[model samples]
Target: MNRTFKVALAAGAATVALAACTNSSTDGTPTPATNGVASQTKSSSTTSGKPSNGDDLNISRFADKPCDLIKPDQLTALGNFRPGESSSAPLGPGCSWFGVDALKDTTFFVTLVTKGDNLESMAENAKSFPIFKRTTIAGREAYSADRTDGKASCSTAVSTSAKDAIFVQGRPPANGTGTADKSCQASEKVAAIVIGNLKG
Candidate 1:
């Protein structure tokens, strides 16, 4: 299997572990009303002052359509990139865009995982990187890390809810010329776009 695939599988496993350990329920089983009345059905709509736990809008909804998260105009603005393949794996669903330039080429991917609380998971994983930085994207907390592979790779984890997040990873194009920071910036930009779509 591909190294990327293996990494994704590992992520998926971690996600499952975290989710199983977290309390995702907002309320327990409904109770009967007085006077032998039935309890009112609770609305699924998000309530004000309540933090999202990803229960209202789960990542599984996009498990098979990750490519739809990005718009065509957004892709054009990013780099006139060609649409790459989409995949559904243990880590969730993801899509990649490929861009080629005279001097550098780039590949950017976006993935969503619903099984875990990425905010906490990123905290632990960031310790392994020398360039991990906390930031915000789309008004949500996020973490950016420079991959050990040097300037060729970058990744960002943006929290979608208390229990889920979307991960964006980018790599310099084959034989391409670009710095690690540039790759990371590109990944962040793509992540913001994807998050914007999700929020809307």
Candidate 2:
């Protein structure tokens, strides 16, 4: 397969893997099993009585400057970091920021997927998430997934519109001592910042 196809496939597979980790009951609602494991519910098309259309935001504005989605100050708040790197992908534009010093080896990835085909693929993959939950960030419908194996990684998907979404994935520094929850929390923090900026 070609490089572009491979990247698209890899992105799709990541989404599917996240969906597969969701621990839900047959009815699609989140439930804690008898074993005491709690599952996050799959969100519907609407959230907080609001539609997931993301009409108030424009994702295209950031398509060419995904790296600028988060400001330098925000990166400093997240942790010591190097400059961001940019790339293009089938999904849209992508950016990555790495941690510095003690966190020098860790990185956070953000991407915008605007094509209808890509979003549809992600929507299908979202179904397999064992811990997908609806959330509101900057008054937009958002979903998040946690690593099932207790790793320091988190993924968040924000619905920019019916056919577009922003994907944020974060991993703790390879040599850092942060916990999985901390890593996910960091991901959420970054997602919140990104959504806030997009709303501007």
Candidate 3:
């Protein structure tokens, strides 16, 4: 946790700008549900084989403890970043993790946007989000964007509802140990897990 790493996203003539972000060792197990919400015993209700709806993933229940949104086992599966470290970003309240040891360059986050714009609106505006592309994650509507300001960031904005988006972001170490696409791949995996564990 004392070591420093780098992720290269050298800035230049670009149309995008990824927000600043900034995990890997939890040997116990997946964190249990807080706020008295029961953990899901069945497969992801939010991830059924079909598409997602506005009510698919509601994180309001986790507003007090955003880190609990992800289970540690799932985090372990995704390069095991350090345990959920809650943080604040331009999007909203969120948690971040950085891989330790050999998992360097592996960094990811889950941000809850209570008042942020949805993917469609963000794309349509083109002022705040200039490079948003429609996509899907675990049957949920999503959008992907990379940091154009150079900093190496890959983000998948999941539409919890047509009006709300959950920001799942990824970035390599600043030491150039990773790339935006690869980080994004990791972020997508995390997003899928989040969706899979969402309560019905």
Candidate 4:
């Protein structure tokens, strides 16, 4: 369910990075850890892993290189995506899209878009989804989204800690139609792998 995210072209794209204080960790929960680059605090004080070269986590990898962690068979690329300073990766399908925004050295923002019959209609259609259950990793917060209408559907997820955050999203299609579901699901899973494989 992969598609190019056209939302990047829209003006005033909302910045959804979890690092911002304004965006509460999906659950409104708090962690007692200092925010530092490459440093992270798990929910239980467990060592998730270390970044490579004993250096702080650098999000530049994803920005600089397009790693195809998502298998071609698992999902087809609707097209190529070029992330901007404000928007990390913007890719879309015929009528759906996904992207992210980096909040800091360790945090990246995210967004998901579905084709709307019109601008106002799209906003209204997006309201049907509910915030997912929050999962805290290394004392950070995370969550996903699932929404639908008679003609379109979309979902998204965000993982965050004191040090960094990852955002993933998808939009299959209306009535379980397009690749949005698979894209959203695979993107979130790949995001976890990226975070889990961090070297710091």
Candidate 5:
């Protein structure tokens, strides 16, 4: 995805973030699943809905840019790339930089995905998670557009402590030009871990 897009948060903060994880395809069809997981069917379109507004939306936990949560061992670091700071080398696929402004204060967790990763794989390797749900974020009608094995390439917007936050997720196989079916699963895993680890 070479373009940048803005998404309006429920709190009315304007975020000029990345949009359409990848470029669009002619058919907009996802490449066949060669990863031994079942392919996902297209999801029906729906009108934007209301956010949970509390249970799943929290940002206070992450506002400070906790050094403790930056686990290099768990996530391979690609280093920071501030917008407009041009470089000669190509920023490889899946390379992203999370800034202080990118993370809302109440956000206790963040999740990233590359294509071909599945939800079951994450859940199996993760700490713990709750059952999946198809819900909205910041009043945008969204759904759990994942495959049966739980593979997708999408993001999550959650609210906690009466504040709004954005959790941008990336999943792989390139998916041609759309969100991966496993993205929903990745969101679930991320949310569960973040929620479970949060302390009052």
Candidate 6:
């Protein structure tokens, strides 16, 4: 079931040269690799907050190394995992992290929105998702959304600036279990970790 979901996502990734992402490898649990980007360590400030909406982080650099967004300690704390498994969608370059027990643990993603789709635009497409409502992570404004009810996959899209944003998505184990709240929580956790790594 998990492999099927990732394949579907990866299929979209192949539509364009830039869209290189999905959640995991379709073959099986992969040997953790970062596609040549340097390995990342967690920052001390994974907490969230922004004094003003204009105060956004410059996240464009991570497009080439999306896996660096995840703090190593925080990621490993979830389970024996590393953020890599690169693939992409029209949204942007993405790196995925799947728990060692792929079928039983959670799946995570961090995608840099290189395109023009930011939080404001996401609101325009709110009707497309069952849960596209406002929220905050790491002190920045965002929206938590899912096509379904987040029973499996959920994401938090954070506005980094007027021009770009970052998307952090999480999925429960492929066993077809997990509630909407739990899935969204996973997304929120990953988003905070990414925001903490951003400078400027």
Question: Ranking under TM-score, best-scoring first?
Answer: 6, 1, 2, 3, 4, 5
Please estimate how well model 3 matches the true structure, expressed as its whole-model Cα lDDT: 0.52
Decreasing lDDT order of the candidates? 6, 1, 2, 3, 4, 5
For candidate 1, the 10 contiguous residues with the lowest summed lDDT are 32-41
**Model 6 regions lying over 4 Å from their true place:** 1-54
Candidate 2 lDDT over 1-200, as tens digits, reads 23463355346434433333354557554332221112223335222233454375687988888899999888877776668877675456778775554234455778776544232334344445455556765666676665353255666767676656677777666556766566667767788898888877
Please give the distance, in angstroms, between residue 33's alpha carbon in candidate 3 and its true position after superposition. Answer: 33
Clash list (residue pairs), candidate 1: 105-173
Q: Against the hidden true structure, what lDDT does model 1 obtain? A: 0.59
Model 3 / residue 145 / CA error / Å: 0.8
Show the colliding residue pairs in model 2: 19-128, 19-129, 20-128, 21-130, 22-129, 22-130, 22-131, 23-130
The per-prediction CA RMSD against the true structure, in angstroms, equals: 12.5, 8.3, 13.5, 13.5, 14.3, 11.4
lDDT of 6 by residue, 1-200 (tens): 35675675444334322322221445422111121111111111211222336676888777777877776787777666534687665667878776655677786767787654555554444434666678888777788876666787777777787666787767678675798888888888888878888853
Per-candidate Cα lDDT values, in order, are 0.59, 0.59, 0.52, 0.30, 0.30, 0.62
Give the C-alpha miss distance for residue 16 in model 1, angstroms: 16
The TM-score of predicted model 3 comes to: 0.64
Top-lDDT structure, candidate number? 6
Residue 109 miss distance in model 2 (angstroms): 0.7
What digit string (tens of lDDT, one per residue) describes model 5 on residues 80-171? 22221111111012213332233321111242222222222222212122223446543432333322233324444333332122333333
TM-score of each: 0.67, 0.66, 0.64, 0.35, 0.33, 0.71
Best by TM-score: 6
In model 2, the Cα lDDT at residue 178 comes to 68
Candidate 5 lands at a TM-score of 0.33
Candidate with better TM-score, 2 vs 3: 2
